[model samples]
Target: MSIEDRKQKIIAEFSMFDDWMDKYNLLIEMGKSLPVIDPHHKTKSNLISGCQSRVWLQARYENNRVYFTANSDAVITKGIVSLLIRVFNGLPPKEIIEADTAFLDKIGLKEHLSPTRSNGLTSMIKQMKLYALAFKTKHDSDKKED
Candidate 1:
């Protein structure tokens, strides 16, 4: 599905909760459901800087798609990253690069986070885009060479 559609689905899901605490519990559940990253990928290279919690993100480009795996030391932080990965994973690099993340505001995720966690969320998004940019550049270059 398109990023917009997936984002809308997330918004709808979040809207189901009238209470922020319940939403937070949902986040924790989502975090628990996030796939565990390979221990090998839990290195400094995959670690995102500026997060109040330790977050490790890894991406691979395959057949024009970017697959991301991530983990966080904090459950809430992990949940945030899982949400990001759910929106971003298994898509072409250009799609990921161009996605509008305003749905974050729509779901009140940004307002709900602590200042430090908010910064961490921004950093996670930045890194995901950076990976996509790299894959896009490589794809463009490969096309030009053909």
Candidate 2:
């Protein structure tokens, strides 16, 4: 599915829950569903700095889209990472760049996260976007070389 469709689906799913706790629990559960990364990839270089929990993120470009794998030592943090992965994964560089995370505010994710947690989340997101930017730059440079 397209990222837009997935966004809508996520919004819809969150709407199904009446309480923030329920939604938060569902987000954590979503994190549980993320595929595991290799232990070797969990090094300090992969760690998302500023996160209260140890979070790791890795990205790769394939078939004109970006794919990511992530993990966190804390379950709730993992869930937050999963939400970010879902929102950004499989999107082309341009699309990923264009995406506005305003939905996060609408979903009350930003409001509910503690200040430190919010900072961590922001760091994680910036890292992911950097990956996208790097991919886009390399792709463009390669095309120029060709």
Candidate 3:
């Protein structure tokens, strides 16, 4: 599905819960479903620097698309990253880099997060886009060489 469609689905899911506590529970449940990051990719190099908890993100480039896998020491952070990956994964690097994240606000996630978690979320999104940029640059260079 397209990123907008995936984001809309998440917004609809979050809308089902009237309380912030319920939304937090939903995030934790979503965390449980996040795929575990490979042990080899969980290195210091992959760690997101601004997060209070350790967040390791790794990107793989294949067939002109960038795919991400991430893990966080904090459950809420894990869920947040999972949501981002759901929207951005398996897409072309340019699409991943350009995807709008306003759905996060529409879902009431950003406003409800603690200040530290909000910073961490921003770091996560930045890192994802950085990875996409790197992939796009490499792919563009290779195409020129070909």
TM-score of each: 0.93, 0.91, 0.93
Candidate 1, pairs of clashing residues: none
lDDT at 98 for candidate 2? Answer: 75
- Which regions of candidate 3 are displaced past 4 Å? 112-118
TM-score for candidate 1: 0.93
Query: Candidate 1's error at 66, in angstroms?
Result: 0.6
Tens digit per residue, CA lDDT, model 3, 39-106:
99999999998888888999999998888889998998898888888889899989888988888987
What does the lDDT read for residue 137 in candidate 2?
Answer: 95
Residue 25, candidate 2: C-alpha displacement in angstroms:
1.3
Residue-by-residue lDDT tens digits, candidate 2, 1-146: 88878888888888898898998889889999886667878888999888767888988899889988989989887887888788888899988877877777767686534456445877887889999999999999999999
Q: How high is the CA lDDT of each candidate model? A: 0.88, 0.83, 0.87
lDDT of 1 by residue, 64-84 (tens): 899998899899989989999
| Pairs clashing within candidate 2 | none
What is model 2's C-alpha RMSD?
1.7
Better of 1 and 2 by TM-score: 1
CA-only RMSD, every prediction: 1.7, 1.7, 1.8
